[model samples]
Structure formats: structure tokens, C-alpha cells
Target: MSTTYFISDHHFGHKNIIDFENRPFSDVDEMTSNMIAKWNAVVRKEDKIFHLGDFSFLNKERTQEIVSQLNGYKILILGNHDRGRPRTWWLEAGFDEVSEYPLIYMNFFFLSHEPMYMNKQMPYLNVHGHIHGQKYEGRHYYNVSVEQLDYTPVSFEQIRDSVVVDEEQA
Candidate 1:
């Protein structure tokens, strides 16, 4: 069976992101290769991956080149930087699907590029990216930013099993 994975903020070809985020790579090439290996180490061809966004700062061809190396059927939700390009651009850049806004998955999880205002009073748990190193302090928030995830995609089941939100909130 195919697993569903989540990851974000690759920021490929964006050199300053290395310094800004304290990523452990010398250059964009190294970062891209390392990320590809890490992503494919767990994800497979049949798997699905939700990339919450900020995927790259490269040109479309370069972006497609990097995307081609990764495993899984990729889906992207637009992030702040990603807004510069149209959905068609991301699709051409090799994502299988793209969403301009947040999506609800598995009925109760709110999937977004930016963390939304989620509380126990709300039924949905927010799974998001955008804030690379900083995190929201609550069981209601899950950050899948690459910085938090060792540059590898995490399984949806892993995210689901790790949280214990109140069902009464529904």
C-alpha cells in the first residue's frame, strides 16, 4: 500500500535560505540532492506526498528537474513565496496536483501552508508549514516544515498517531 507523506519549504535554488534557516548544506545542489535521497528513502512511486509549499525559488525548468528526482505523487498547497507563480506553473513544474488554499484531509485535519488559528474548541487539527524553525505550542498544531523534519517527508499516519486531540471539540 502507498503511504501519504507531508513536507514543506524546500526553497530549492534559494541560496540565502541556507543562511536564514541554518540548513546543513554548502549549496543548492547539495541541498537538493540530499533532500531527494532523504525523501526517496521512505517515500515510493506509489505513495502520495503533500508538499505544503515554498517548494523552490528556481526557474520552472530547474524546478521540474528537481521535482523529477523525487518519489511519490506530489501535491502542493501554495505558500507565501509560491504565490508568485500560478497553479499551472506548479503543475508544469512536476506536481501532480496543486491547491491555492488550505484543504481538509481525512475528514478532520486542516492542511495548510501557513498555520491557521486552531484550538481545542475547533474540531480540526492544523497541519502546516511556512514557519520553518519556530513552532506553535499546542497539540492542535503540527508543523511539517523541512527544518523540523530533517528535510525528509513524514508519513500522514505518523502525524495522525502522534496527536491526541479531544473528540469532544467536534
Candidate 2:
């Protein structure tokens, strides 16, 4: 079975991100290589991965090259930095799909590059990125920032299990 996964904020080709995020790479090349390896380690070619944005700092040609080396059907939800390019550009650069706004999935997960404002009365969970290592304070929110992950794409099953566990503890 091909699984669905989510991840964000790779910032490929951005050198300052190393010091900014305190990422463990000496430079951009090392960062890209390591992150790509981590991504492929858990995601298979047939799996679907929703990248919630800030994908890269590289130009289209370089981004396409990086995207082609990865495994899975990729979808990008444009983040702040990513919006500088037209949606069509991202598609041409190898993403299977690209969105300018948030997407609702499985009728419950609200996926976006930035967290949407929600309340306890709302009936959906917000899965988002852009905040890097920080996270919001609610069960209704899930941050998929690479800093919040094992530097690998997170499967839907994994998110579901985490929600279930948190609910049980609540």
C-alpha cells in the first residue's frame, strides 16, 4: 500500500538556513544530500507526500533537480518564501501539484504552509509548517516542520496514531 506523507521547510540551496535553523550541516550541499536521503529512507516512489512549503531557496532548475531525486508523488502548498514564484512554475519544476491556499484532507486535516486559526469548537486538525522548531498549544494543531520531524516525511498513519495517543492521554 502506498502511504500518504507530510513534510515542510526543506529550504534547499539556502546556506544561511544552516545557522538560522541551527541545522546540523556544514553547508548547503551537505544539507540537501542529508535531507534527501532522510526523505527517501521512509518514502517510497509510489507514496504521496504533501510538502507544506518553504521547499527551497534554489532557482527552478536547481529545485527541479532536487525534486527529481526524491521518491513519491509530490504536492506543494506554497509557503511565504515559495509564493514569490508562480504556481505554474512549481508544477513545471517537477511538483505533481501546487496549491496557493490551504487544503482539507480526509475531511478532517486542514493542511497549510501557515497554521490557520482554529478553536476547540472547530472539528478539524490543522497540519502545517513555517514555524520551524516551534509548535502551537493545541491538539487540533500538528506541525510538520522538518525541525519537528526526524528529518523524514511523516506518514498519515503516524499522525493518526499520534492524535489518538494524545486524545487518550487527554
Candidate 3:
């Protein structure tokens, strides 16, 4: 069975990101390798992944190479850093879909590269990335950045289950 996963801000091949983001990796290669490992560990070959963006800071060839190694059918929600590239560039890099704005998933979850407003009154929860390790105070917003999720792709089921658990506790 295919599962849906969410992740963002791998920033592969971006050496400065290590220091800028205070990433745990000693170097870009280590960060890239380990992130690929973690992704493959949970994402099956047939699984689908919504990559919330800022995916890489490399030439087209290198970026495509990195995307090819991962185990999932990838979709991209463009982030600020992803702005300069053409849509074709991302598609050529193996993304099944690319959206310039937020997408509503399953009619109950809002998916975006940047965190958007949400509350219990809203019809759907907001799932986003882009703030790195930061998190919003509201329970209706979920950040799936690699920094927030331990450099791994989080399954939608996991998010849904956690939300259910949180609701029960409240």
C-alpha cells in the first residue's frame, strides 16, 4: 500500500545551511546522506511525499540526482528559496506535482510551504514548512520541516493520529 508523507527544507548541497540553521550535521555530505537514509527507512518506493520546499541548493544535475535516490513519488509545494527555478526544473527533478500556493489535502488539511493561519473554527488544519525548527502556538497548524521532524518524512497517518491523541487529551 502507498502512504503519504510530508517533509521540507533538506537544503541539500547548501553548505551555509549547516551553520545558518545550526543543523546537527558536520557537513553537507553527511546531512544529505543521512537525510536520504532516514527518508528511505520509512518511505516505500511506491509511497507519495509532499515536499514542502527549499529542497536543495545545487545545480540541476545534482538536485535531480538527490531526488532520484529517495524512495517516494514526490510533490513539491514551492517555498521562498524555490522561487527562482522554473516549474519545469522541479518537474524534471522528479516532482510529480508542483504548486505555487497552498493545497487543500483531503478537504480537511491545508498544505503550504509557509505556515498559514488556522484555528478550531476553520474547516481544515494547516500543514506547512519553511520556519525550520520553529513552531506556531496554535494546535491547528502542523509544521513538517525536516528540522521539526528529525530529518525524516512524516506520514500523514502519523499526523492524523497525533492530532486525534491531542484532541483526546484536551
The candidate that wins on lDDT is 2
Total clashing residue pairs per candidate?
A: 0, 0, 0
lDDT of 2 by residue, 1-170 (tens): 89999999999998998899899999899999999999999999999999999998998999999999999999999999999999999999999999999999999999999999998988689999999999999799999999999688899999989999988998
**Alpha carbon deviation, residue 122, candidate 2 (Å):** 1.5
Q: Which candidate achieves the best TM-score against the true structure? A: 2
Better of 2 and 3 by lDDT: 2
- The Cα RMSD of model 2 versus the native structure comes to 0.7
Candidate 2 achieves a global lDDT of 0.94
User: Which parts of model 3 are misplaced by more than 4 Å?
Assistant: none
RMSD of candidates 1 onward, in order: 2.5, 0.7, 1.1
Cα lDDT tens digits for candidate 1, 46-153 = 999999999999999999999999999999999999999999999999999999999999998899999999756775789999999999986788999999999989
Ranking by lDDT: 2, 1, 3
Across residues 69-105, which tens digit of lDDT does each residue of candidate 3 receive?
A: 9998889999889989988999998788898888989
